[model samples]
Target: MTETTKQPIRVALVDDYDVVLTGLAHMFDRYRDRIVICEIDANAELSDQVDIVLYDSFAQPESDRQELAALVRNPRASRVVVYTWNFQPELVESARTQGTHGYLSKTLPARELVAALEAVHAGERVVSEPPSKRVGSAPGLDWPGRHEGFTERESEILALITQGKSNAEVAALTYLSVNTIKSYIREIYRRIGAASRTQAVLWGVAHGFSPDHHRIDHWLGGP
Candidate 1:
């Protein structure tokens, strides 16, 4: 008797930023035989039925139970996994309580990410070891404002501001100090030639800083 080959895990990437989801989708390119990116949803509905929905938590509130609950309730997704940089104990427990199958770190390499997803698809609840405070984002990831000389963190701050998040709200969401958020905002203003928050919002809106609401199916040749 011959053993049957396992099928690649169908995955849907979920996030509000197109650049963030697209960059994440690229990380799985080398693992195409094991993971197939079925959809890339940006503030959009999960249209396809997939084995896993990898929710990238970029520029989103870490403690958003409503969003997590919605994903968990989606019948199209067999499981929901959080891909985040913030690993606060409360946040992890909240995700678990909300029925997330995995709470993975953003510092995981592409290969390790694929393996973790495989474990999730195999019915195992996977959680990555907490990454060090000094660890940055995984290599080869991209975000908006990269071409404008904004670091990923700075871009996140700007993106939040564009979404009408106050300085305190941004601090709370990203776990950054208010002073630090202000400093990043100052630098963002300088780089974008904006001196006021309204100006910054206008600039961000014009420069693709707002959250997207569409699917990037074409990235993986989906119809």
Candidate 2:
């Protein structure tokens, strides 16, 4: 008797920014044989039935469980995983209590990310090792302000600011110190020629820093 081959895991990427989701989708390009990207959703419903829903926590508030809970309740997704850079204990615990299957770090390499997803699909709850603050982002990821000389971290801070997150709020969401958030804000202001938060918000609004509302199905043609 011959053994049957396993089918590729169907995955849907979810986020509020198209660029963020697009960058994440590209990370799985080399492993198409094992993973199939069904759709990239931005502020939309999960349209396809998928084995996993990889939610990217780009500029979103980590403390809020409303969106995460919605994903967990969706019947179209068999497993929900959070792809985030913030690994604060409370956030991880909240996700777990809300029925999130995996809490993966954004610092995970592409290969490890795929493997973790495999583990989740195999009925195992997975959480990545807590990464050190010095660890850099995984290679080959993109964000809204890369071309404008913003590092991924800086870009994330700017995006949150654009969404009206105060310094304190940003610190709370990213698990960074308030002074550290201010330092990033200063750099963001310098890069964009903005003197005040309002100016920076305007610049961000003009430069794709706001949340998007659409779905990207072109990568694999259609969901």
Candidate 3:
């Protein structure tokens, strides 16, 4: 749906690391008109705070069933989603049994992530795309220095630029306007000390921001 026609979904993000919360908040910035991030906390009292609670397990991917259950029990939020890098089928099933409304992959771009959260808020169960249904490997932008100064959106755009994608292609991938892509690129170049796209690509490759080898299991699911 177009942003103009959609209702803004109230969301609360729960993650242990401050950096993760900050990055997620920044990543969702563009969707402020459609997705309102009402809270960012490690242990927030979500009762009555949001329509959906996104529980991101940045460090430990597995063994969060009890935590998920607790979040589900909270009366503040109507739904809960486990947003993580690990989407093993067993883990997904375990989270479902624990009453999580959704299980999402970390590899999902900002648009898809927002869509999944909206679906959960609508009283639907959402799961990450299984490995076999997925197409060819997407750029694995999860590299070192990700926690550095660059925002999550900047890192994602840089990853696409390093892949030699033009601004239009990057816009399409990110579901953003071309003008927005250009603006972001300008800022990214300034931050990374690059005078041109070639220089940006070089900087990204040198600093380990380039996509790494794709593992079959990784394609199956997870961040």
Candidate 4:
């Protein structure tokens, strides 16, 4: 398709890790003629910045429903899509309810990824079928936190920390105080044998602690 006739979809990537962002940038580089990545950001808000915001959840199993809702509710963002590995049935439905235009698996090749983005830009709600089974054991590995005696609260904190949130940001998102967030991080580090945030993030990524099993009420404080 001619560049004039086929306009590349403008995409903005949202991921906490620099590596993910950089990798995605390179992956999509070949499709520059079809898709243009306008920006890469960790912040949740972008006022009409681009045609689509792709939220990557490689390390995050639980889709942050609140963040998805906010992006959909904002008139500025034209479209929002969750690029994730977590396709729990309920999570997919919850994301749709919150205005996500698409839910795609990370396993999709770059060409399919581009097609999905194009479909979303065309105003379709796209949810790719999950693989009949997880490709390999590598994707489903979970940290033995429960067996390690970690509490539900600790699990939630670890999830957010892995997503690269600061103590203040985690406190704001979870409706807890900064000091409380710090204390939880300390205890989590001690239990998990992590000496720093980087170590904790790496552990979380490895063991799938990035996706906490949180009810909406747990983070949103609803009845």
Q: Which one is best on lDDT?
A: 2
Clashes within 3 Å, all models in order: 0, 0, 4, 1
- In the predicted model 2, the residue pairs found to clash are none
Q: Which of candidates 2 and 4 is the stronger one according to TM-score?
A: 2
TM-score of each: 0.94, 0.95, 0.57, 0.61
TM-score of 1: 0.94
Candidate 2 C-alpha lDDT tens digits along 4-45: 999989999999999888889999999988998999999999
Scored against the true structure, residue 85 in model 1 reaches a CA lDDT of: 80
Whole-model lDDT per candidate: 0.90, 0.91, 0.68, 0.68
Instruction: State the TM-score for model 2.
Output: 0.95
* Candidate 1 Cα lDDT to native: 0.90
Best by TM-score: 2
Total clashes in model 3, counting residue pairs 3 or more apart in sequence or in different chains: 4
> Where is the poorest 10-residue window by lDDT in model 1?
214-223
Decreasing lDDT order of the candidates? 2, 1, 4, 3
Tens-digit per-residue lDDT, 63-155, candidate 4: 577677777877767998997655678778888888788988877878788888999999898998775544421222222354567654576
Off-target runs (Cα >4 Å) in candidate 2 are none
**Which stretches of model 4 miss by more than 4 angstroms?**
1-4, 136-223
Deviation in Å, model 4, residue 185 alpha carbon: 15
Candidates 1 and 4, the one with greater lDDT:
1
**Residue range 94-208, candidate 1, lDDT tens digits:** 9999999999999999999999999999999999999997868898788888888887778889999999999999998887799999889988989989979999999999988
lDDT of 3 by residue, 1-223 (tens): 6665766787777764454565676667667776877666654445345688788764333455667787888888788888765556677788888888888877787888877877887789998876443322223323234656775557667867776788998776565699999999999888877898889999977875554332111111211
RMSDs, each prediction?
Answer: 1.6, 1.4, 14.8, 11.5
